[model samples]
Target: MSRYPDVYKSWQSNPEAFWAEAAKAVDWFKPADRVFDASQGAYGRWFAGATCNAAHNCLDRHVAAGRGQQPAIIYDSPVTGTKRALTYAELLDEVEIFAAGLASLGVSKGDRVVIYMPMVPEVAIAMLATARLGAIHSVVFGGFAANELAVRLNDAKPKVIVSASCGVEPKAIIKYKPLLDSAIAMAAHKPEHCIILQRPMERAALIDGRDLDWSALVDDMRAQGAKAACVPVAATDPLYILYTSGSTGQPKGVVRDTGGYMVALMWTMKNLYGVEPGEVFWSASDVGWVVGHSYIIYGPLLHGNTTIIYEGKPVGTPDAGAFWRVLSEYKVASFFTAPTALRAIKKEDPTGSLISNYDLSHLRTLFLAGERADPDTVTWAEHALGIPVIDHWWQTETGWAITGNPIGLGALPVKPGSSTVPMPGYDIHILSDEGHPVPQRTLGNIVVKLPLPPGCLPALWNADERFGPSYTDEFPGFYKTADAGFRNEDGYLFIMGRTDDIINVAGHRLSTGAMEEVLASHKDVAECAVIGAADALKGELPMGFVVLKAGVTREHADIEREIVALVRERIGPVAAFKTVRVVARLPKTRSGKVLRGTMKKIADGIEYQVPPTIDDPAILAEIETVLSNRPVVG
Candidate 1:
């Protein structure tokens, strides 16, 4: 007796009518005549012949509906010791002023505006303002290097750049101005105007003519009584271009459409997250990432839910209790975060004592994304938090959760290692390398049948040619996810790492995720990652790097032996899981995905390019040090 079984059946029967009904949730200037048009092949147009303003629907409509006094955004920064809440009415005023300010700077419709700022309230304001003017925004991660920033700027060719003077981290004050100046100096296409948000802690130098202070422009607009009206754009208009790391050196800009994106995210708020209007929601992710873009800014506001902008690390910001503290203080109903954050907390506090201190009665559900949540971590969290730990699977390109545990519809039976059934509007199938359907329980490539659900990436910015080839060329009319996984008889999808992550040991393909899950189940292992290292005899051998529990002072040799035995017993001897090295930390991206490719290269003694998006470059050197002392396994 699921509450949404009928809804799912109806959507499957007639997807066009179903999505058309869902699109009505948002305020559209002109309603769409057709729900989906796939005549252009894999690059389909959704909500054709419709007009809408994304920013207006997210802000103004909520105010007009008499929810103006409801909390819209709650900015919580533990590092800066700052907390502020803005209601829908106040948020609209700020957005209007900023939108007007951007217009005054000659930023109009269709212009690209690059935002290189931290996780502050102004970051969301700048994005809303950019959308309000029908300009496309590209937000680069604040922690990205100047060279990385320059590459994005050169690609987007933005007319104006909005950035902050400094970002406050727990241990250091990151002066963003120098980075911005360096990037601007390096880029061939320089922006005409730069708007800088000055933080009082550490101010950076600003060139008088080129740089405009945020307060000066906004205050001037307020004094002059200028109001910026939201501009209506075509349904297929680009809302934002997010650059995701490509296998090659260059990053791919994933373009999201305004009309479809708004409609899809609104549906997700009610269905996936089970969040209602005026409820508090917190997504502990940076605005640079897609999770922050959909959940932190657009999705919640589109549904009139209060979203929390958190600016602090998971473990180091005071203690491991930061997440629990935020939940208790804000009375957050749904909490979304990455598994890496939970692993970090588990490493520091094995007994969950830090979490026990906070009362999280208001926390309705905890959603895990970004990377695969290890079963051990999932079990630990569920036992400790006393709430449903939903592990949903999605990508930056998908915009929202594709396959998730539909707790909002009905709490499905918990499957420890699986990201449950595909939501309505998505037709997911497991296909072999030859693009044929694979049997249940057999590992294969995961693909979505075209046309992809609304809110999916329409095309890569300036790389329309690459979009189809990258996603759909392998399987005609199907979007190859590049992820390796299998769906069970019950339709529960279990993602078993990436297709490239499969290791051929003695001609047998083995999943690194399967091996890592086995190793992580060890009581002493706090976190672990497995990568296939090149072997002369077996083609490739499984190598594991593990981080032990904080208080566990067990000898490395003993722990490694136990983990090797555990893997052997669980995955059998075919896995060749012999080498296990205990490391202090794993090389990971800011989003918490392990650099498995980098680890494989380091272990195989092959030259590798260091990814610029890595959270800590020093961790690579640490892994190299660990590998140098350990002899290669045969």
Candidate 2:
């Protein structure tokens, strides 16, 4: 039985007591010795003595109890249009054999294995195998360039690397093996073995000794009579070290231990997505990011739910209709995606009936993260998909959503642009620039206070001093989110945007998001990116690059006038962009955040690496052309 309490309570009044109850909610074989360990480190441990296998909790326990015949996975091919339904019995078999194959190659407990493959079934198998054997899995996004991949591989020094020959995206067929070969070629300290998947089968100039065919490798293992088994490891043993995207600089590897990650992750299942037993949930995020790690991969699976692990982009091979078709095909009860994808696809098929094309009657929740979800997207989802869009706030460092609205449980007055409330057990206080706590309604950096979150990484792996300075030491007493926000008089948390994203216009500090949301609402604009451009006098001013929908002409004067008027109507004239360049599209990452830093470099004539992450690299060139040809208007 479950004693689920009322929504808005003093969840933090007794933090340890509240967490202890949560730790018991899931299946735990051996209990933890302590619930909290302050002396251990900041954001101290919960379930400190817990010794359990994550793979068993997710797969084995349910399957061993006659639930093996149940549907465990529902996969759809990106191009072939084939459907593959995996039962728990079959999934367990795959995990077991894969674990054995890894062991055969000398990948054992405490060793690192970097997974650089697509979102195929094998990727999940590799992850489970690593977990089952007590090895730390560092799964990097397959699409990252060789430079990025090599940096992570060098950092972790994984014993093995698993990559695909090639992969797919919306606008291109990514040949990843070359990058893998290039990385291995350049590695001064490389992994002992490299396994390659043969889907979409294309090979490059091969480095024969380092790489081997993946299908041949795993197939050989299943023939070896591998059975489901979990190696006993310390509760404190690391499970994975997912590296953060290096939007600023070199990526930092985030270490998630066995006990803390599992405990914090399980709560996310029942609470965040409102994931119920046997529900079909789907989060449209890559396993590369934290959202995928928490919601898409771990949270849903932990709850014994059949979730969707999509391979292609939301807008690939088709338009916005593609997403709806999948939702209709799977009858997804919970659908999640980033705001950029929502903005992009909605323009391609704006009738919003694309949602109706599918049988979405089962859908109860639509979750959005990676970037702030605008009110228009929420209203659109409600009217179109017929589900409430629950906007949440979290970051790579935090590991899971820190501030978000729970599903139907705590409905404070619905603010159009606010995330509404801090999640239970997360203490949030707005702090001034100097780190002093600020009064309500005053915009400041949002900081998470003492009694830190367990889900939040124990520390950036091998960079404890880096964690102290970047997150903890700088602020003295709080984990400064780097995100800026303010609580209204009614206590709703309004996310103002990242402090780095703020722009100053004639001495007035303005959030680029507020301005962009108003611009995004323009009838002709499909999507727009607002970035802070270095200005001579005002320090920094807002510059926008917009992508208009089809049939919407590039009328510089008309569109510019309308946007300026829209800003005045919505906010004021001062908030208007001094420059609006109507272009084909904006540059964005795979997780769907606009690459403002890339745009900033372009604006400053500074050289930058246009990501291999975007669906179209040509769009950046289009934006550059738009900026070059535009007439200066001051």
lDDT of each: 0.91, 0.76
Candidate 1: lDDT of 573?
93
User: Which segments of model 1 are wrong by more than 4 Å?
Assistant: none
Clashing pairs in 2: 32-49, 32-50, 33-49
- lDDT (10s digit) by residue, model 2, range 570-627: 8777774667777766787878888887887777667788665564577778767766
Say what the RMSD of model 1 is: 1.1
Residue 13 of model 1 has an lDDT of 97
lDDT of 1 by residue, 125-163 (tens): 999999999999999998578988998999999999999
Candidate 2: misplaced stretches above 4 Å? 1-10, 203-209, 408-413, 611-615, 629-634
